[model samples]
Target chain A: MTDATASLGSAKTSADALFQRKRLTAFAVPAVIIAYLAYIAIAFDVVGLAQRASGENAVILASDSWSYKTHVTRDNRRGGTTYAIEGERKGAYEDGTRPAWVSGDEDSELVIDLEDGHVVRFLPDNAVAYDVPGFGTIEAQLVDGSLNTNLSDPVPDWINLSDQRMTVTTDAGRLTMTRTRTEVFRYFPGWELFWFTLDSPYHNRSFTEIALGDRIDPDRPNISGAMSDFWNNGMWRHKDVAWAIGETILMAFLGTFGAAMIALPLAFVAAKRFSPFGALRFGMRRIFDFVRGVDALIWTVVLARAFGPGPMTGALAILITDSGTFGKIFSEALENVDEKQIEGVASTGAKPLQRYRFGVIPQIVPILLSQILYFLESNTRSATIIGAITGGGIGLMLTQAIQTQKDWEEVAYYIVLIVVMVMAMDSFSGWLRGKLIGRKD
Target chain B: MTDATLSGPTRREVDRIQDSYMAQVRRRRMYGGLTLAIFVLLMVSGFVVADDRNAGGFWDGWRQMLDFPADVVSEAWEKRANLPGLLVRYFPALMETINIAAVSTLIGAMVGLILSLLSTRGLARWPRLITVFRRFMDILRAVPEIVIALVLIFILGGGPVPAMIAIALHTAGALGKLYSEVAENADLKPVEGLASTGANWTQRMWLGVLPQVAPNFLSYTLLRFEINIRASAILGFVGAGGLGFELRNAMAWGPGRFDEAAAIFVLLFGAIVFFDQISSRYRNKLTEGQ
Candidate 1:
């Protein structure tokens, strides 16, 4: 009884010690994490992040994503006023046509109500007037190769006045005047001319109208014509976007399946059961590790030098990097293959190829297929990144649009497309997995 | 006895079964062969189309593929003495890349833990809002880190913070999904016990579910850390600040700066392999228990 008590007492002490260690870690882990975070905050200059951040750019990106502006400009040299959406030639109003929001003809005082009690008047000879609701009317005109604005000694922060130029910014719109031209940007919500450009006869028609109405254009059916116009929309470039998405998917498809095809044979060599020579297996494994370690980014840069920038280069880069990963994964799966299955096949008087086909392939197919499908989905995302670097797909278009700094709308559109594309790929892979291998969940 | 009745009829029935089974086997083989044919067709056509879209055709390009690597290696060899100095110079950038990954992984894992716990069916605090959280995670995961990094870079200027934030957001989504998968299988007994003891949602999750899933969660976080290192480097290439940015600049300088490019390559490769080895080792240790 005394010996039992002593042993029980020792067990209690050991258990207490274990609890003590756990207790220390419970506090220590959080402490360590907090300290590391503090260090990162200092290292990353988090305190100065606010100062470095551009509020103006943020506002511009946010506002421009959902809103567009119409530009009314009068050239001092040419002596004519023209109206265009977002100042693009493709969105330009015809010589006599204009948005209903703009009142009066070009020959007379053109009054543009920017809404919210803010208005702009485009008068003759490159002269412009802007009326901010809270502020008084500000007038500007080009005079003798220089901009002259209304009298004010101390200009508000909203109005930027210089020797040769003046700009007045307000909630509703903006007005700018220079020797070359006087322009007013009237703000409007929503993406205008999204479905049809100014040149298309179906420009202002609704979806129902296009679907059900009498043919708007005599040359073609209404729905088809609208679709053609929308697909060919200069600003949106829906066709190019569709092709980009296709190319991205193509990269993922070719890369993943090609890698699988290449890796499967190589994986056999890497696997111990399949390959008798250990050295060859080691060497194959190293090759797999090297390729994986080299990474897609390096492969992209290297392959891009030879292939030049395109979907093919991105595809090849993905192919090479993923081949290594697939090789590693495939070999591991191959190594884990049940020997009983192979023996069963061999017992049936099967040849080596038949043994592999009957015994090994069946066992590993579901696992490999699931992995391949998962990679297929992920590679789509990778293809987007590779496309950006190597210049192909929606990623390229996105990077280019972003680099311009003013195509936030296009950037937004591309972002939506990319996200949709990735989600769709995810669903496709999931569906395929379910169909081929039975439902995982 | 039944001999007279069984003999001819039994033999004919066996023959019929054999022929029908063979026919069924043939049908299965035909379906498999058709699928294989379709796959081959897709592969061949895709290759051709990709080849067509390429600026340099595959046939022409494959031969010259080694040219750039050879030049870089040769240049680095000639300037071999500078490699050590170059590695030292770029070490801090490498560290920045590593730190971005570490910080993001930590942040992501912490967020992922909460998200997974909340999203899991039995563990959810608000069951009705589960789909809301799921779709939120889906959107986060759907967005490529480069998209957020590029946009953030515009607002924040070129920096590591953007990359960190971008990667962290993606990691959260990814780890959340993975963790929830693990959590789905977690025993609810401990959770029920804690709740019976008057524990709140956070308390129950912290004390019951977290301890149960910690090992798996840690293993996944380590794996994500390795991936995030690569991601952070890629982000840098797009101007988010790290080894990739330096490498880009070196490449942009053209021809003469191949030595610097080679050093950056060496550093990136070494770091990736090292982290991969270490993370996989620990992940093995963690997962081996289960």
Candidate 2:
């Protein structure tokens, strides 16, 4: 009876100790997690301060619509004077409409109607679009005349025109007027946070409304098109993104396949059984170690400099980077193959080549194919990074968009495309693995 | 008759027999051509397409290799002044990555223990459950860490919150798979003894199953932690802030700050080496019962 009591007491003590251990572990885990979170919060502040010290106001500026119209002229002997102004209307507009285009009091500027063929001879200066309560969307058509032409379409239902504004400038003068952007353009707000920004003197004064003066060249490129949904920001078009993505994938596919081709022989030689010689084996292994140890991005930057910026450079960068990795992985797989089969073939008077051809090749083929497929998927992401750096692929476009602080909607579009591509590749690799290896495990 | 049947041949007889044997070879050409045709088809279609698609530039790759050592050294030199501050600012966040690895690995190890026990066919009545669990794990492992981060970002909102959760989920899946493999390969003697003693399932698992694979489970968890550290860096590229955020910013900003970017790489490499040594040491100690 005493022994039974003592045993019960000891069991209870042991159970209590186990519970205590579990409790301690649970507490310790959360404590570590919370402490880490605190650290991140502090780190974020440090990053923010660093960014701000460089005169960067990282906060995204929220604006609904920004429009500018400018007159471009051919100074060279290439052509006669041509007048072109691009204006963002609050609503969808047809190809042409003649509004009383206004400009500064300079007579040398040529004016054309917003409509297809209405060319107006206006010498006056600045013209800005202002929303007239009764007129729907109206801008100063001209400085001298009230030839107001209605915008081709009304304010879109989704876009709030109250917050919209525009700016117009000609050789004569500059004009600022409020106007709304198209509904499609208003989907993204606060998109500016993604880019590095330096503080401008004009704060909160919202260059919301303006007119194109002579300095506002219609041909002047806006580097910030990626982040903004401005009328002239043509980089967000589907065609551009598609072309970029296609080039990047081509680069990745070619690079992976090329690397695999080179890597297979090197891998074969690097394998312990295949080489049997210590010197050659060690040399190949060290080479793999050195190349694979370096990140693929560094190779890309190098390749871009050596080969110049192109898809070929991107592909080469990937090839050099992937060869090292493939060499290592394939060599390890070769080392792990069943030895009895090779021994049987060798004992039967088959040469080394014959042994490899009949014995080792069959066993490792499935694994090699599987790894190739896996690397192909991984290389796709790597390709994106290379493209970003080299200014050659979809990554370039995405970076440009981010730099311009363009609409988050555009960012969303590109991210969706990349995700879909990654998923498709992943699925293909899985399917191939299943087909070749028979997913028994 | 006795000498001939016993296979002892005279020299002249042996020479005549050898000549007759070498006269005609027994060749099976029927299936030989079929296999050769198949081999050719396989090589041309697969290798040809692969070769043609990637044939644009191969031999010329050497001309493009950058002098990386010089660049890395210059970068390190430039960041020498900010080295202390950079360490202070970013080291804690890196430690956070380690913390994340620890919590996720521990929790994952526990859940894996449970799954691994159930996955074994010897102990579990429902064998199909093992298959289903394995397939589920395969799917989980199929998705990359970044995609998982993106999905979790949408579900759980942005920030490190989603990254931690995503890594944990992947850890659970990965560790569970390795754990099950260990459990499946464990010795059955102790398990059999526990079963004969009328112990319950949990008791048999604790006393019988776990002890056998404990060292293996510990080692796997450590290996996963190493992988998770790398994975966490990548998650930062998607705004799940980490060292990747800084790396991306530096790249986006251009070579003007390449030094800072190189510094991050150095820190990353250092962290990896330190963790690897610690994990291997712990694994060895656990295995050696020291």
Candidate 3:
């Protein structure tokens, strides 16, 4: 009875110790996490980041991504007013033509509509009146190399009045007057010139009208002409964008399959059962490690120098890096192949090559194909990044658009397309895997 | 011998079976041949297209490939004494890159853990919103890190912060999927037991489910950390700030700065291989019992 009591006491003590450990762990983990985060916050300079971050840039990016601004510029010195979308030359309205929102032209007083009950009138001589319904009309004149504005002493935060320049910001739009130019930007939702440019005959036509109605451009068929116009849109560069997406996918495809093709034989040599020479197998495995360790970004830089920046460079970068990965994976799969299958094939009076073909290939093909398909999906994303470095795909276009800083709408479009493209590839690869593996089984 | 001993009907049956087997073999061979032909065609055409579109043809480029590497090596050899100093100078940048990856992994893992729990059918905070969480994670995973990094850099300005945020988002989606797969297989009895004791959803999850999946979760998170390190370095090339940023600056000089580039290359390669070895070791240990 005494012995049993002692054993029970020890067991209870052990159980209590275990509970104590668990309790300590529960608190310790959170404390460690908090400490680490605190360290990171200091290392990353979270406090200074607030000051460094540009609120203006943030606001601009947020607004510009989903909206566009049509620039109505009145040349203070040149005595002419020009209207352009996003103030780009490519999106410029032809001479004597103006947006529907702008009623008149350079020849006459132009009345600009800003929607939301805001209107701006370009009067006879470099004078502008902006009517904010809530506030009074803010009048500005660009006289002899200076901007003169009529406002009270205490200017509203939304309006900046100066001798050299006058600026007004409202919900409807923005207006700025300077010695050289007076410009009003009328904000609009949706990406303009995405489907058709200013010069296209199908510019303002609805889709049903283009598809079902008479040919807008008499020279070409309606549907074909619309497609041609949309594809060749100078503002959006849809043709270029399509080619870029194609190039990105092409890079991924060529890279993944090419890597698989190159790695298969090497993997065979690297595998223990397939190869007799240990030194050679070790060498091959080391080569794979070296290649993989060097990383894709490094490989991309090296290959871009050799290939001089294109889809080829991107493909080669992915190819070289993924070859290493596939080699490792394939060799492991090869090593794991059941010896009984090969023995069975050998017992059928088959030669070594035939034995591998019948035995090893069949066993590993499912794993190999599944891995290849998985890599194909991921390589598409890698290809985009590599393409940025090597200068060949949608990544380059995206970088170019973002670098311009003002083409936020274009940037947004590319982001959407990239996300869609990646998801599509992912699904495509998944479906292919299902079909192939299902057939195999 | 038994078949020969059998009557005419049995022999005819044998012949019919042989004929059907031959037809099956013929059809399989034909399909195999067609697939091989198509693969060959695609490879040849893809190579041609890539070659044609390349700025420099393969023949010209392959010849000059060794030139760049050779030049860098020779220049670095001449400036061998500066190598250690250069490496030292760039150590902080490497540290920053690693920090970006580490911080992102930590944050991404926590969010992913939550997301995985919410998305898992048997273990969910909101069962009705499973599809919504799944789709949200899918979008997060689908968005390339560079896209987010570039856009965020535009808004937040250039730093490791943008890269960290971008990679964290991607990692959350990736780890969430893997975690949910593991979580889905976890035993529901413990959870039910905890629920019977009146444990809340979070409490039940914390006590019952997390211990079961923690090993797999840690392994995946470690693997993701390895990946994010590479990603963070690459992002730095686009001016996100890290080793890749320094490498870019070194490479931009074109000739005189080859030694700096060489030093950065060595450091980056060493760091990648080192972390890769460490994470793989730990991952193997984590998954060993399971």
**Global local distance difference test of model 3:** 0.92
State the weakest 10-residue window (summed lDDT) of model 3 chain B: B1-10
Residue pairs with backbone atoms closer than 3 Å in model 3 (clashes) = none
Cα deviation at A406, candidate 1, in Å, is 1.4
Q: Which scores better on DockQ, 1 or 2?
A: 1
Sequence-dependent TM-score of model 2: 0.55
Candidate 2, residue B88: the lDDT equals 69
Query: In angstroms, how far off is B206's CA in candidate 3?
Result: 1.2
The interface RMSD values of the models, given in order, are 0.8, 8.1, 0.9
Tell me model 2's lDDT, rounded to 2 decimals: 0.59
Residue B16 lDDT in model 3? 93
Model 2 agreement with the true structure over B134-230: per-residue lDDT tens digits:
6666555544455455544443444565576677776777787788877877888998899899988888887887767878887888888876776
lDDT of 3 by residue, A18-86 (tens): 999999988998999999999989988888887888998989988999999999998888788888999
lDDT of each: 0.91, 0.59, 0.92
DockQ scores of all models, one per candidate = 0.82, 0.10, 0.79
Candidate 3 lDDT for residue B161: 92
Write the residue-wise lDDT of candidate 1 on A209-310 in tens digits: 889988889999887778888999998898999988989999999999999999999999999999999999999999999999999889999998999988
